[model samples]
Target: MSPEYAIEGAFSIKSDVYGFGVLMIEIVTGKKNRFFTHPDHNLNLLGHTWKSYNEDRLSELIDASILESSDQDEVFRVIAIGLLCVQQYPEDRPTMSSVMKMLTSNITLPRPKQPGFFTERKLEEADTSHSMLCLSSSNHSITTLAPR
Candidate 1:
């Protein structure tokens, strides 16, 4: 959920935009944000992606299985658009039309600010801990929620 809807019980089209952004990032990463984990950090995929961008290590965010086959530039472009869609404030996120333009055009995009709902904590607390996990396809997926 977007921070507003998750924390404040607020709802708006921006919230949908946030979900859209999450979907984009999820698609690009080939991983779900909710069950994301990293052995070296306690960030969910969202936090990790933001950190990766700020650290000039965004390339590390790509799923290895697809990295070799996908155009790096296009992948990064989509990541950029995804980040823009999940900006912290609802007013800061793009409209659906804006997203379409972003996907279809080569317009220079503004730097995306921090995404909403960023949280950092150990993966041991993942909500899926008590549930059975069924991993497959190069062991890259989980079937439970793991919000930050």
Candidate 2:
């Protein structure tokens, strides 16, 4: 789930864009976004990818099998596009059409900002606080469904 959907109850075309980004990252890395792990950091796949990209270690983010078979530059471009779709704010993320252009053309892609839901701990904290606020309020049974 995108951070805005989980934390702020906001959903839009941008949310689908975020989901697409996560899917692309999973395909490129051969790892599930929810289960990604690195011994050296607490970041999720998106956070790790962003860090790797910034540190010039993006090649390390790809799956070994993909690395052996795929063109490195193309893989990097896909990863960059994925990161672009998952930026923290909807406004920061590219439109789907823009993403397509970036993927298909040689146009220069903008650098990605930090991704939504970058750390599990931060999400947990937000959920905890929200639960506490709910409990303290008079209305304790209200539930709302987020639009998919």
Candidate 3:
């Protein structure tokens, strides 16, 4: 790995954890993980997911588009898992090892309280050439020369 990738690799496990969080959010909401807009709130899907989790109405974050096809228990579990990954403190978040255990095993995973806000994407100002210089868990991890 390049020095930049090496840096990101240092954080790779945590980054994968974050990606899992976004994936779970996408699965529950039937929306892309990036740039979601809700009618009532200006916050993106991550924000909405965080709000729903915090408000004890995480079920509300489930997308109406696929409601009937979803399993409520599994959905809730995934939501909780997502929130766990998105915790603001890296230490509070599960490592991929723990995440895999949480997903596959019957062990009782810790309850996830709530997720912090996901940083917004700012593609307009992004530099196409040097985008590969870094990897980021926040925003879209464009390979920009910006700090990872």
Error of 1 at 23 (Å): 0.6
TM-score of each: 0.82, 0.79, 0.65
* Cα lDDT, all candidates: 0.85, 0.86, 0.67
Candidate ranking (lDDT, best to worst):
2, 1, 3
Candidate 2 — which residues are off by over 4 angstroms?
A: 120-148
TM-score of 3: 0.65
**Predicted structure 1: lDDT:** 0.85
Best by lDDT: 2
Q: Each model's RMSD to truth, in Å? A: 6.4, 6.9, 7.4
Error of 2 at 124 (Å): 12
Candidate No. with top TM-score:
1
